[model samples]
Structures are given as structure tokens and as C-alpha cells.
Target: MFALCDVNSFYTSVETVFRPDLWGKPVVVVSNNDGCIISRSAEAKALGIPMGAPLFKFSDFLRQHGVQVFSSNYALYADMSLRVMTILEEMAPKTEVYSIDEAWLFLQGMEKLVGWQEWGHEIRNRVQRETHLTLGVGIAPTMTLAKLANYAAKRWRKTDGVVVLTDPERQRKLMALANVSDVWGVGSRISKRLNAMGMKTVLDLANADTHLIRKKFSVVLERTVRELRGEPCLALEETPSARQQIVCSRSYGVKVTAKDEVRQSLCAFAERAAAKLREEGQFCRCVTVFFRTSGYDTGGEYCSRQGSMTCQVPTHDTRDIIKMALSVFEKIWLSGPRYAKAGIILGDFYHRGVAQPGLFDEIQPRANSEALMQVMDSLNQSRRGALWFAGQGIEKPWQMKREMLSPAYTTRFSDLPKVR
Candidate 1:
């Protein structure tokens, strides 16, 4: 059997974990720079505040409804996610971390020993009690169906956040009630196509001819159909696959026009990307720098530029990556245009100890690079944003605005929750 566990209103729930006073209040978490609503609590959703609604447009509405807003605190969310995933790892023998707020667990042969529904309930309750976060659990014979069950668990209140679908009749009834779009892999386009073909419900697509679906859509859709019919086509990934590329980018807090400001932003991004590469135990041979004006900026000439450079050697050293990134940034930057965002991309990856050396060129090995990186990472991990490169600049004028950010309750000792 398979089980899918998803946190309910992950960001808002994390916020409430440390601020019990905010419980049962209308809470919404916005994206970077207070761009838009990304996560809303049940109370906030009841107020008809749609997801992704720009914060500026809803200021009056938010004030009238007494809705609390917060900027995205990724540090707190990431640490909380690690704690939740650790609990799942302890409970299940095999698990796949699907996303920050979701995971899939394989419960092979456990059906015969215990009641599956009760086990699902226990998982949900334990997670809630231990993490102070609510979760929905869906269990079924296949991963796809397990996802569907999870949807039902979250959608309905009577289930108490746990739903187990083991019988064929119950699965078909649930599928019949669910729209085609609610299925695991069906997007808006696929839903429209399926609706046009008279497959409006999950059961309709599950009963449709697999060959026709394959011919009309794709092999992937056909596999979804089989999985909905109680066939297991997707398997849990025990380990996450290596990333092909690592990108670090962010919108600036304000419009920047100076070359020095742009250079500092690029340097910071390159440092972050290089750190990610080293964390994954990989080296990159290519670094790309990109910057662009705000899409909303209508005044003057709008500009966007990107440039790539191949490294002299595959290296994960932050200094080497940042040097190349800044050099490329100089080539692509436009002086007249006001830049609103900048990013760095690290690609052409090779696993450590697997990079081939250039035949005719001499490459000096940095004997202390590994040790230096270890110390850097250790300090940064111990205290968030504790280490920095001199080139990144001390006064970061381009940093994103996070005015409504809450204290880092879990990661920082000074920000820990206190009782009077």
C-alpha cells in the first residue's frame, strides 16, 4: 500500500505553531517582496481572499476582515519541514519526500497486520501532536489513488484528515465525485481536453480506453489511467535524483541602476549557487548570469540580458564561480536600463572526482578549498546567514523586502519562543 501525507496550510500552520494567539485567525503568507498571497489559512480562505491575489489590491479588504499577513520565512519553513520529514522517516521503512509539505510512504505488507484506516489516523494524529501542524493522510493500493484519497481527506471534514481507500467500490465512488482536474497529473489543458471528450470525472477517465487516451494524449496519461484502475505505475524514490542545474535568483527590493549594485547581487547569487553545488557533491563547468528590468516598469527602454561562460575547469569553489559570474555580468549588463532582478545558474555538472582535466592547460589545485567550504557551511548552518563573502557587499540595497517576517522560532536561538 501507499500513503500520501500533506501539511494543511503549511506556512500559516508554521506561523501558528509559535504564535498560538494567531490560531483560528485569518492568516495569509505572501511571496517574496510581499508580491502576493501564497498560503492562506482556512479562515482567510473563507473570506474569499483568493490565492495569488496581489497584496496591494487587497489592503482595504484585509484590514476590514482583520486578516493577518506575513512575509515568507523560508528559514523557519525549511527547519520545520526537516522535523516533519524526520518523523515520517522514523515511522515508515520507505518514504519519498515529494515536496516541502508532502511525502509518500510505502506500507508494504502492513495491511495484513493492522487496520489501514486506523494506521492512517494514527499517522495524522502523531504528526499533529509532535509537530504542532495538521496533516492529511491518504492510503490506497497505488500512489496515484493515494493522492486522490489525500485530496478527499483534506476536502472533507468528516474524515478527520485521514482517508483509506482499499475497496474497489469506495474508490470508484470517490473517483466519480472528483473532477478530472483533481486527478494527480491532470492540468488545466488536459482537463479541458478530457472534458471535451466527455471524461469530466476521475472515474470517467479511469474507465476510458487506455489505448485511445495514449493515442490522443500521451503515454503518461495512459499510465495515469492504469494507476487509477489500481495498477501501480509509479514507484517511490528512496533517494532524490541529482539536479541537472542549480539556479539562484531573486527580485530586488527596489529598482537598481548602478553597476556596483548589480555586481553585488550577481556575486551573492553565484556564491549561493556554488554552495548548492558543493552541498550536492558536484562541480560545474558553466556559469550563466542574467538580469532584467521589472515587467511592470513602463518608463524608458526595457532591457533583459543573459550571458554564459565556460569555466577553465570544473570547480565548485565559490571564488572561481563568482569571478566568472561577475565577468559575464559585465558583458550583459545595460547601463541605461533599471534592473529589477538578477540570477546565477550553475550547469554542466560533473560528480566530484569524475571531472576530466584539460590535456594542454595547467590547472592549479586549491588545496584548502574543501576545508574552507566546510567551515563556511558549518558556520552558516549553525546560524542563518552567519557567513558572507566580501564581494557580496555589506549594505545589500538589492535585498528583497521582508518587512512582515516573523522571528525564526526554530532555527535561531535568540528568536526562540519565550514565555512570560
Candidate 2:
């Protein structure tokens, strides 16, 4: 058996963890710069506040409904997610972290266990009590089914946040009731195609002929069909594969016209991307810098350009990456309309020490790059103030705005919740 656990409205729920008064209230968490609604509480959803709607578009509606709003508190949400995953790691020996808000647990020989529902609720209650976070538990024979069961657990309040689909008949019944889009790995385009083929329900797709699915779609979709039929096609990946490319970009709170502002933004972004490259124990050979003007502005010229530079040897050193980024930025940036966003992309990765230098290329990997980067990343992540390079200016006027951001309740020492 496989079970999937998913947090409910993860960002908003994390916000409520430290503010219990917001528990049953209409709440939403907006994206960076308070741009759009990203996560909404059940009550907010009931109020018909659409997800991804621009915050400015619905300001009056939110105010009229008394909907509580907050900027995305990444630090608080990440720390709380870690706590939930830690509990799952201890409870289930074999687990795969699917996302920041979801995980899969391998329940070997659990079919023999009579009280599946009881086991699921135990997980739910324990996580809520320990982490002060609520989640849905879906128990099934396959991970895909477990995922759908979890969706049902959260979608229908009657399930009380736990759904068990151990019986084959029960699984089919749930699949019949669920739309094709509700199936794990099914995209909107695929769902529309399935609807045209009269496979509107998950059960219809599950009953599809594997031969036809492979001929019309892909082998990947065929695997999804098989998994829907209770045959596991995907293995639990405990360790996720390292990304081939790393990108760190953000839209500025206000459009920046000054060359120094754009330069500072790219430097900071390069530093961030380099830190992530080191985290994966990888080095990058190609550095790309991209900048653009606001595409939505009708009165100004829209410009978007990117430039790339490749090093002879891969390096994870921030200074090396930042130097390359600025070099590329100098080449690509056009002096004109205000630049709204800028970022860096590190690509053509190599496992540390695996990047062989060309015979003629004199540039070789820096021997002390790893040690220097390790110390820098440690201090930056420690929540003590960042140790930034001079290239990244001290005053970052182009940073994303988060005026209503909640405190780092879990990650920062000073942000801890107060008690009377």
C-alpha cells in the first residue's frame, strides 16, 4: 500500500499556525510583491475569491468580505513543512517527499492491517497536534490513487481529512466520481483530450486500452493508465535528482531605470543561484543573465534580452558566477525603458570535480571554491544578516515588496510567537 499526505492550503495554514485567531477566518496568502492570490483558506475560497487573481483587481471584494491577507512568508512555511516531513520520516520508514506540501509513504504489508482508516487518522491527529498543521491522509494501493484520495479528503469535508481506498471497488467508485483532471499527472490539455474521447472520468481513462493510449499519446500516459488500474509504474524517489539548471529571478517592486540598480539586482540573483548550485553539490559551466521591461506597460517599449557565457571549467563559487553574470548583463542590457526584473541562470552542470578542463583552456576549477562557498551559504542561511558582495549594493531599492509579510515564526529566534 502507498499513502499520500498533503497539507491543506499550505501557505495560509502556515500563516494561521502562529495566529490562531485566523483559523476559521477568510484568509489568503499572496505571491511576491503582493501581486496575486496564491493560497486561500476554505472560507476565502467559499467567498469566490479566485486563485491567481491580481490582488489589485479584487481589493474591494477582499475588503468588503473582511478577507485577511498576508504576503507569502517563505521562511515560516518552509520551516513548518520541514516539521511535518520530519514527523512523516519518523512514522514511515520509506517515504518520498513529493513537494513542499506533499509526501508519499510506502506502507508495505499494510493491506493486512485491518484498521486502515484508524492508521490514517493517527497520522493526521499526530501531525496536527505536533506541528499545529492540518493535512489530509489518503491510503491506497498505488501512489496515484493515494494522491487522488488525498484530493478527495480535502475536497469533501465529509471525509474529515482522511480517505482510505484499500478496496478495489471503493477505488473504482471514487475514480468514477472524480473528473479526469483530478487524476495525478493529468494535465489540463490531457483532461480536455480525454473528455473529447469520452474519457471524462478517471475510471474511463483507467479502462482505456493500453495499446490505444500508447499509440495516441505517450508511454508516460500509458503508465498513468496502468497506475490508475492499481498497477504501480512509478517508484518512490527518496532522493530527488539534482536540477540540470538553476535560476533565481524576481520582479522588482518598482521599475528600475538606473544602471547601478539593475547591476545590483543581477549580482544578488547570481549570488542566490550560485548558492543553490552548491547546495546540490554541483558546478555550473554556463552562466546566463536576463533582464526585461514590464511587458504589461502600454506606454513604454517592452524589451527582454538574455546573454550567456560559458567557462572552461565548472565552478560553484559565487564570485565566479557573479562575475560571469555581470559580464553577460553588460552585454545584454539595453539602456532605455525601465527594467522591471532581472535574474541569473546557471546551466550545463557537472558533479563537483567531474568537470574536466579542456586541454587548451587555462581556466581551471578553484581549489578553495567549495570551502569558501560552504561558509558563505552557512552564514546566509543562519538568519544572521547576509554577507553580501560589494557588487550587490547595500541598499537594494529594486527588491520585491512584501509589505504585509508575516514574521518568520518558526525559523527566526526573534519571530517566535509571544505568549502572555
TM-scores for every candidate against the unseen true structure: 0.95, 0.94
What's model 1's TM-score?
0.95
Clashes of 1: 0
Model 1: how far is 80 from its true place, Å?
1.6
Q: Write the per-residue lDDT of candidate 2 for residues 143-235, one digit (tens) a residue.
A: 888888898998889999999887899889998999999988899999999899989989999999999999999999999999988898988
User: Can you write out model 1's per-residue Cα lDDT over 165-261, one digit (the tens) per residue?
Assistant: 9899999999999999999999999999999999999999999999999999999999999999999999997778889999999999999999999
What is the lDDT of every predicted structure here?
A: 0.91, 0.88
lDDT of 2 at 166: 74
- Among these predicted structures, which one has the highest lDDT? 1
For every model in order, what is the number of clashing pairs?
A: 0, 0
- Model 2: per-residue Cα lDDT at residue 340: 84
Q: CA shift at 208, candidate 1, in angstroms?
A: 2.6
